[model samples]
Structures are given as structure tokens and as C-alpha cells.
Target chain A: MMSVGELLSQFGDKYLQALWTTYGLTVLCFAGALVLGIAITVMRICPIKPLQWFGDFYVQIFRNIPGAALLIVLVYALPYLRVMLSYYMCVLVAVTLIPSSFCSEYLMAGMNTIGAGQIEAARSLGMTFFQIVKNVVLPQALRSTVLQMTNLLVATMLTTALASQVPLNPADLTGIVTYINTHAVGGITAFMISAFFYAVTAVVIGQIGNRIDKKVRILR
Target chain B: MNGAHASIRDVLYDAPGPKAKRRIAFVTVISLLALAALLAAIVRRFYVTGQLDPKYWSIFLRYTTWRFIGRGLLGTLQVAAASSVLAFAAGMLLMMARVCRYRVLNAIATFIIELSRGIPTLLFIYFFFLLAPQFGLQLPSFWRITLPVSISAMGVTAEALRSGVNAVPRGQTEAAVSLGMRSASVFFKIVFPQGFRYVIPTLISEMVIVFKDTTYAYVVNYADLMQNAKVLISNYDALLAVYLVVAVIYIVINYLINKLAATVERRTRAAVAAAK
Candidate 1:
């Protein structure tokens, strides 16, 4: 029957640290996924048949496999090859690769919505392939997929909890929640506090994404 | 300059010339070689460690192993099946609340959906699992996992159903209303069936997610599929082999779900076309 203020005082600093880890992992994974997703999307839509097939294969395999399984495989199996990564790096790589598949699909859908005439118009103006992609296609594609990307960002944030399974880092929010549950008196209240933090962040992210979406639509 | 004549293929790039084809071939060969080398390294490591040994895999032949895995699979299916059913019902209610005329109900539904969507499935499960004892609910272990999973699924299902309902033309509802039918009857008879048909594919996909999410139960010490794998790992110390088996099982199950969903979607589309 601890008061909310007392519960906050008891475990507030550790909870904040855990939240920081969660945020850091989310930002890092989202950035990594964005870069990889762009490359995969480009590969999928490129002129080379093999590259296109490879991109499709990657997405299909990764998307079908459960993220938990993939994380286990990456974290456990890779170490046997003397390619051990830090906990943060392992979580980052796993999260990035898994969600990059979905992000590529979203981006590809966005790219599909760009009319053929837009590309032809760029070509007629003597824009090279890279220039056309960079200056004309990518901006619109990113804008179109902003909402999906935001969803992915929130998902990535949530998925960071899976990193608790990694033995090296037990200080993340999920791990902290587990610890508080075992060690503290008002554990459930602490968990609720943590859940509140995640919900608030998610809502804020959705709002920002909506605002960007609206602005992009207006610019059109 | 009419864009309607050009297709997606035209928007991608120009056709490859002979020189470009040669470059592509060269790049393809190099990439293939790199991939082969990577695979070789992994295989070699496994061979060196004796992870490729038949002895490690022989454990699966044991009846006890089968019993253990079967029990875990059953638990996973039970949680997924129960949660999906509850989630579907909750989603329908949420959708109705959102679409109802009352502003307060709409706002409340929207808030619940957004909050559930924003929170990760893991957190929801954790919150419920912990809070159950505090509130003296005396819920079973399965309910702890099922409740949270259903809450998250409800949010997604509600969104999908709302969009499906929104896609239905307003004229149909208006027509039903003008025919002297009660609004409730019009909703259940006219709006729901058609809207649900439109979202069957999405709902099936969400079920796959719910199935995958049952793995999170491992965190709470629930003996689901992933948790069983963890238990086997502790016993056998064959981490790679156990995880590979677990992953393949998951992939096969998900692939079947996707295949089934695709068939349903095709049939639905065919039925809709016939109706038109």
C-alpha cells in the first residue's frame, strides 16, 4: 500500500536509467533500420534481378521468423564463431535486421505510389538514377511512409524489452521491472509506472508522426 | 505525358543493356561467393564444435522430448487461441464504441486503443501478471498471459475493423435506416458482416502476431514453446540445435497461417467479385 510518491522515490533513479537504455536502443535501432531499409528497398526495386530476388528472400525469411527466435540465434550462435558482440550491439543488430524487413516493405509501398510519370519526368530532365532517387523519389517516399515508420519506431521501442534476455545487460527497463518485482515492496506499482512511461512515449511519437504527415500532405 | 499509361516497371529503371548485364553478372557472382564463404564459416564452426553431431539431435527422438514439446505447443496454442477469441470480442466492442454517436464513448475507446497500441505487448503482460496478485484477482497463470495479449490484440483488431467499417459506403447504412429498420439491426445485419468480410485478411494476420507473442510468456515463467526450448537448453546444453528446431517450428506454423489466410483472402475476393 505504498503511496505513488513513495514508490517513485524508492526506485525512480533506476527506472530512469532503464528508460534511458530503452530510448537509446530504440533510437539506435530505428536509425540503423532506416538506412538498411532504404538500401533493401532500393535493391528490391533495382534493375538487377538477382539483387531483387535477394531482397525479397531476405524480407520473407526475416519476417516469417519470430523476433525472439532470431534474437536467440544471433546472441547465442554468433558467439561460437568468435564474433561476440556487446549486449547493446547484439540487441541493436537483431532489432535492426528484423524490423528493416517490414520497413523496406513499407518504403516499397510508398515508392509504388509514386507515378511512373514522375520518374520519366526526372529522366527527361537528364537526372541520373542516383540523383532522381535522392532528389525526387526518396523525399516523397519517406513522407508517404512517415506514419508506418512511426509505428515501427514504437514497436522497436517495445521490442527493446526483449533485450532483457541478453545476459550481459540486466539494467534495461524490463530487467529493472523484473528486479523491482523481486526486490522491492511496491513492485506492481513500479511496473505500472514503467508502463506509463512507455505509453506516454508512444502517444507522443504518434502525435509527432501525425503532425509530420499532415504537414507533408499540405506541402503536396 | 499521361502517367496512366506507364506501369510500376517503367518507374523502376530502364532495361539493362549488354554492358549493364555484364556488370550485374559480375556483381552477382561476387555476392554469391561472399555469401558462400560466410555459410562455409558457419558450417565449419559447427563442425568443429561437434554441433553437427547426430548425438545432439538424437534427443528429439526420445518420447520424453516429444511429450515436453507437445505440451509446450499445446500451451502456446491454448494461449493464442483463447486470447484471439477474447481479443476479437473486445475489438468488436471497441469498434462499436468508437463508431457510436456518443462523444464520450468514442473518446474512451480511442484512448484505450491508443494506450494499448502504444504500450508494448511485453509491458502489458508484465503489468497484468504483477497486478493480478495485488488486486487479489487470483487469476490462473494462463490468464496472466492471455489477458495482456488480448488487450493488445483488441487495439489492433479495433483499428482494422474500424477501417473496414469506414471503407463501407455510408449510403448502405443510410438506406437501411430509411427502410424503417432499427439502427441496431442495421448495424448488426448490414454493417458488421460486410465490414468483417473486408477485414478477414487483416484479422488472420493479427492472429499470427498473437501466436508469435505467446513466446513472451517465457519471461513470466510460463511453459510456452519458447520457454520449453529454454528448459531443453538447460538440460542438453545444445543451445544452437534447440533454438534452430524451435525457430523452424515457428516458421512452419507461421507459413501455414499465412497460406491459409491467403486462400481465405482469395476466396473472399472471388466471392466479392461474384457479388458485383
Candidate 2:
């Protein structure tokens, strides 16, 4: 993974490991975002308008604000308010809240597409509200939104790489490049390293997304 | 029983089902449960680290990170503004080329769009940043590094504009051409006015992305929020508190912007579509 020149050896796992830390932070942040995004989306679709507004506002801000700026507010400003979270936590928080807006929008559209006749039929049978939704509507909605959700999820994964800008240690594959770059310091080597890692990740995620999407569409 | 039948809406995609309330409730429950689990895990991770000291939080607040945040914000805005305009212009030019009788212009526009659409945006910018430095033509840093950020922004803005321009129909151009109008005026008067509406939501989304992308500056070690957060995280390891704050703020800002976009999308959709 390394040439181990004097400069590279000096930093050792220092730079490389930092890249790993970046990976960890990124994964955690997106994972959090995926979950939170789903939840906010659900809230938006619920029967309550108040909860919907709450969800809407959550999505709007997360969607609007710059990721870095948001990260700053979390990292630097919160402590001022006595609600300080760590940098890792801050990145996760930002990613989760922001991405949720996207997920909810996608999901709501899916929910909205379900035919009204089915619901009325279930109501005619006097089925419980939760049972009718779970057994009937969601299955249909899920079918329609599956391809879309897959795309959004993959896009979210790639976008989450932005977490690296929190100055990800550039370890892992990018670490090798980061290693070379710091040695070359201000050289294209670092850029190339990150680009390579990003490409690999993007391709992998894109392929997975495409495959799942294709499968979903086929059945649909 | 008589009230059971209500007037059905004409919109094709509007309704879910009659048991809408029940379905919504189910979705709500499942969503909350999952979110709760994620929050719990983060909390667990937070407590495991055991560095929730107020002294550290205080020290963290008093750091130079605030200055970096301000500067980083400015950098983010600069890139968003510049690239958005550039992207729109580029998109329009490309759109016109796509619609033009000239094969050469159409080919060029198609090539540009394909080249951009195929690549991961970050990779594009990373490469662009390298090349921009070579030419000494990039977004300059007024408060921070300008060139890198702007190039990245331009790439995305360009994509948005392409779509905007395409939304215009051939009829408008044909009418303009019949009036003996030149290509440039047709674009400015007929195509642009109509196309720019489509670009609005996309432009807003691009702006959000650009702002988010300012975090990319951290890769170059330019001080931005994400970069600062990482530094602080390692320096203090207050991962939870920091992330919670970051998530809330990002959500808050993005929420406002998207709301405006949604409002515009609704109004425009009604005004533009119904008129037809």
C-alpha cells in the first residue's frame, strides 16, 4: 500500500489511518441519514399535519444548507448552546437530517400513487386502519417506489462521500494517494488518489443500485 | 353511509387508497421505530467515548473554528452563485445546439452533456481543480480557495441548465424563426423565458449541492465546517454532540430552501401547465 519513503514512513499509519477514519465517519453519517431520512419521510406522510410540517421543515433546512456549514454549526455552535456533539457525531447528524428530506419526498410520492379504490374496499370490509395499510397499500406503494428508492439510496451513498470533506483522513485506497500527496504535498498525486477511490466506490455503488433497480423494475 | 362516496380528484397520482389513514399510520410507526434505533446506537457510541466534559465543549467553542466557518460559508456561496449562472448559460447554449439545424453544434452539446453525465461529479471537480490550477483560471479565493469550489459548482449547474433548456418546445423556436428572428434573440426571448422556469428547482438543488460541496475544500485542507468538525472530533472526540448539532443545522437550512422550491414548483406547475 506504500512506497515507504522517509516522508511517508514518518507519517506511517498517521495519514493512511485518517482515511480509514474518514471511511468510518462517512459510513456512519450516511447510515444515520438513511434511517433518519426514512423516518422523517414517514412522519411527513402520517395523518398529522403538525408532524408533517415538522418533517417538512427538517427536510428543507437539511436540503438547503451547505453540508460544510451545517457541519460547522453542529461542531462549533452547539457547544455554545450546551448541546455539543463530536465531529463524527456532527457529520452523521448533518448527513442524516439532510438526506431524510430527499427520502421522504421520494416515499411520499410513492404513497400518493396507491389507488384509492383499494383503500375504500378495505374500509368497506371494516378492517383496522393499520391492518389495511400494512396488508394492502404499503405493498403496492413499495412496488412502485422500489426503483426510485434504490436510485436515491445509491445516490445518497455516493453523496455521503462528502463526509470526507470533513477532511477525512484519506486512508484506505485514498490513503495511499493521500500518503503520496502529502509527500508530494500540493501535488496531483493526492487528487488522483482520492479520485481513484471515489471512482471505485462510485462504480461499486452504482452497479449495485443498477442491479437492484433492474430487478425491481422487472417484477414491477 | 351516504357520506362514504366523496368527489374523486382528477389528478392521476394524487391518492393512495381509502384506508389512507391506516397506511399512513403504519408507515409512521415503522419509520419512527427505525429512527429510534439509529439514535439509540449513536447515543450508545457517544456514552462509550466518555468525553462529554463541559470544559472541552467550552474550549471547543472558543476555538478559531468560527472564523473558518464564516469564511467557508462565503466560499460556498461564491461557488454556488457563479457556477449556477455559468451552468444556466452553458445549458442554454447546449440546448439551442441540440435543437438547432446545425449538426456540428448539436454534436458538441450532446458531447458535453454526455461527458458530464457519465462521470461522478466529485471526480470531475477533483480533476477540474487540478487542471484549473494549470491554466490559472479557476474560482479565486476571496476569503478562501475560489477556483476549486467554482469549477465544481459549474459542472452541476451546467447539468441543471441543460434540462431547463430542453423543457422548451420546438414550437416556440419555430414561431420565432417565422418572425425572422435570429438564433440569439429566439433563445433570449422565447426559449430562455420558458426554459428558465424548469431550471429554478434544479438551480436551487444545485445551489444546495454546491453549498454542501464546499466541504470538498477540506480535501485540500481548506478550513470549512466539515473539515473543522473532523478536526474537532479527533481533537476532542465529542462525536455525538457535534454531529447532532450539524445534522440539525443542515436540516434547518435545507428545509427552508426546499420549502421555497416546493412553493415555486407548485405555483409554476399550476400557472404554466393550466395555461396550456
Candidate 3:
């Protein structure tokens, strides 16, 4: 078992690299989820019945499947069907798919808060369909979901822990803990160091989210 | 009508005029065809890749296979039930401490809640799986998964419970106090019960999360559904079929739990409205 000082001095560089990797994965996955989520939300609320059903089916499937299960299928099972993704790609796909479902749900909830009367008002002004969506629906939904998207960012970071399941070139934060524990008797200090990084990042995200939410929150 | 069930679907468009209806109908037909084409393409890929072979899927036809998966599901349910109970208890205690007038307790409780909620469950599981043993705390595999899962869940549960408590009208507490009731007794008998009732739906939804966390039981080598699915995979040499089926099983179970939560939420809303 390594002491706290010994652990940090010995593995300080790895911890920094792991933190960077975690940050990179979180950002990329979240960006992907947001784009995909917005598309799904559009499908869900669109007037086309089949597209709406497809969107609903997509959300239910992704939202209900466990992260580990999805990762395994993406990494292992997909190969059987001749659709092989790299380890990183599999992790990215799994992480993005799960959160996109949630992101869509939050967006829908935010959109629901915008009353029908507002749409009618927009229509009376001769706003085109796309114009109403862009000017009215999108702005309110995006603003109101600031906090939820913030939490989703944190959740995306956590989901990157799934990276530990696969062997990546530079492991993420969770993967580093596993790396250290296996190679050396890093003990509780190893776990604590990683946990500290996660907690601090989460706190920072929460504070920023609160500030933004306060600015943009609709009183109604 | 100014109904409460107004959703984004209602707000996205006005009632379609004649031309708009025709356009929608045309788009619907086009989308239906596109969706069918997509499905056919996927099946074509399966056929090309030989994934549609009977050998890949035939194990499901046997009753014994289901019994094994069912047994594993029972294990999953057991872990989920235990963790949910433990998390609920911890959450209640934390919520009470948070609301009470003790500064020290409040600070400590708040810290724990943040720590638990902020950190990922995998980190907690690693703490138990890897770190605890170094300190001579050797937990069984079951406890390894259950403890961390419950710990991860308790913080969110505490927040949910606190929200429910906040929703309870201040007048109710004041009314109880004016009736000469003690604080703790009043809380337990009057405030907490109503608060608990208010959050029943939220708690049930939280159970979906707890059940999902239990899927991490694989790390500790616990015989939850995923673990058992691994066993079946090894024995049958059918990775795609077994894993896909297992994933469906999880989705279905969670879907049902969500439906149950929605039903409870609707009924409670009605009951509360009727009471008003």
C-alpha cells in the first residue's frame, strides 16, 4: 500500500493525463449527444407519425439499456454482425446514445413548458413553421434546459468511466485508478485522488450551471 | 382548452388547414416507406453477415435457457430491492438531518450528499472492491456491489425526499405546532407521511436508476442477470444472440418499472386533486 504523498509523486503525471483524457471524452461525447438529441427531439415533435414513432422507439431503447450492456454489445456483439468499431468509438457511441435519450427527454420537458397559446400567437404574426420553431420553440427549450444539460455534462463524464472496460491508449480517470491498482498497490489513496478530481469537476460544473440557470430561467 | 396535459406536440403546430393536411399525409406516407426500407436494409445486413442463422438464435427455444435467465433476473431483483431499501433509509435520515436545526449535522450531511452525488458509482465500487481490502475490510461480492450502489443512489434520493418535504405547505407544520405537538412527533406523524406520499412516484422512478446501477454487479463477479448472461454466452458460444436478448430483457424490465411509476404518478395526482 502506497502512502498518499508517495502515490501522488509516483503517479502524478498519470493522474494529470487521466484527467485530460476524461475531460476530452466528456466534451466529445456531450457534443455528440446534444446534436443527436436535438435531431431526435425534432423527430419526436414533428407531425409525421412514423418519424415520431422512430424517435420514441430510439429514446426508449437507449434510455432503458444499461451502459455496461450497451458497451458490451457495441464492443463484442456488433463484430458478429460485421459492424466493427474501434474500442474508443464503441465507448463513444455507447456513452452518446444513452445521454442523447435523456437530453431529448429534458428538451421535450422544456418545450412542453412553452404554452400552445404562444404557438398560436406566433402563427397569428404569420411566422413560417421553421421560423416559429427557430424563434420561439428552440430558444425557450434551450434556455430552460441549461441546468439539465449541465447535469448531463457531469453524467457524461461519469459515463466515460465505461472507458475503463475497454483498453484505450491513454486511459480516462476511472481507467487510471484501475491501472494503478493493478500495477502497484496504490490502495485507497489511488481511489481517493481520482475521486477528488471527479468531485471537484462536478462542483465546478454545478456552480457554473447555477449561475447560467439563474440568468436564463423563465419565471413562469 | 387550458389543460394540464398540454405537451410540445400540441404547441409545435396549429390544426392543419386543407393543404397542410395533404402535405402531412404525403410526408407520413413517405416516412412510412423510408422506415420500412430502413428495416429491410438491416435485415439484409443480417442475412449477408449470416447473423440470421438459426444456430445463433435457437438456444432461446429451449425452456431451460429461460429458466437460467429468469434465475439471473431474480438475482438482479434481489440486489435492486435490497439497495433500494438501504438507499431509501439513508436518504430519509439525510433529509431529516438536512432540515433539522443542527448546524454541524447539517454540514456533515450536506457534504456526504454532495460527495455521493458528485462522484460516480464506479468510483465507489472501486473504493469497496480495491481499497477496502487493503484496510482489512473484506466485504462479500454481494455487499461489494450493493453498498456502493446504495451509497451512489442515497444522495439523489435525499434530494428528492427534501423536495417533497419542501412541497409540504408550511401551514401544515405550523398547524401541527399550534396543536401542541412536539417537533419530532409532528414530523414523523404528520409532515413526513404526507411528504412521503408526495414523492412516491419519484422514489419509484429512482428505483429504475437503482436497478440500472445493479448492472454493475458484473465487476464484483456477482451473479446478476448480466453475469449469468455471460455464463450462457460461454456455454452456448452465442455472443450476439445472448447479449442482445439480455439487453432486451433489461430494457423491458425497466420499461415496465417506468410505466408503473407513471401510473402511480397519475393516480396520485388525481387523488391529490380530488382531495383539494
Query: Each candidate's DockQ score against the native complex?
Result: 0.51, 0.17, 0.72
lDDT of 3 by residue, A1-220 (tens): 7888899899889988999988988999999999999999888878888998999899999989989999999999999889989999999999999999999988887887887899999989989777887899888999999999999998899889889889987888888888999999998788888888888898899999999999999989
Candidate 2 off by > 4 Å: A1-39, A48-65, A69-97, A139-151, A163-176, A184-220, B1-76, B91-140, B143-145, B170-188, B215-253
**CAPRI quality of model 2:** incorrect
For residues A114-160, could you state the per-residue lDDT of candidate 2 as single tens digits? 56777777767876545665676556655666656655554554454
- Local lDDT at B272 for model 1: 84
Poorest lDDT segment (10 consecutive residues) of candidate 1 chain A: A166-175
Name the lDDT of candidate 3. 0.90
For model 1, name the residue pairs that clash. Answer: none
For DockQ, the strongest prediction is 3
Provide the overall lDDT of each model, using Cα atoms, as 2-decimal numbers: 0.81, 0.57, 0.90
DockQ score for model 3, please?
A: 0.72
lDDT tens digits, residue span B72-160, model 2: 44554555566556655665566667767899987886656544433334544544544445446554333234444444455445556
Off-target runs (Cα >4 Å) in candidate 3 are B1-6
TM-score of chain A of 1: 0.93
Candidate 2 chain A has its poorest 10 consecutive residues by lDDT at A169-178
Model 2 TM-score, all chains together: 0.62
Score residue A183 of candidate 2 by CA lDDT.
52
For the predicted complex of model 2, DockQ is: 0.17
Candidate 3 CAPRI grade: medium
Candidate 3 lDDT at A206 equals 92
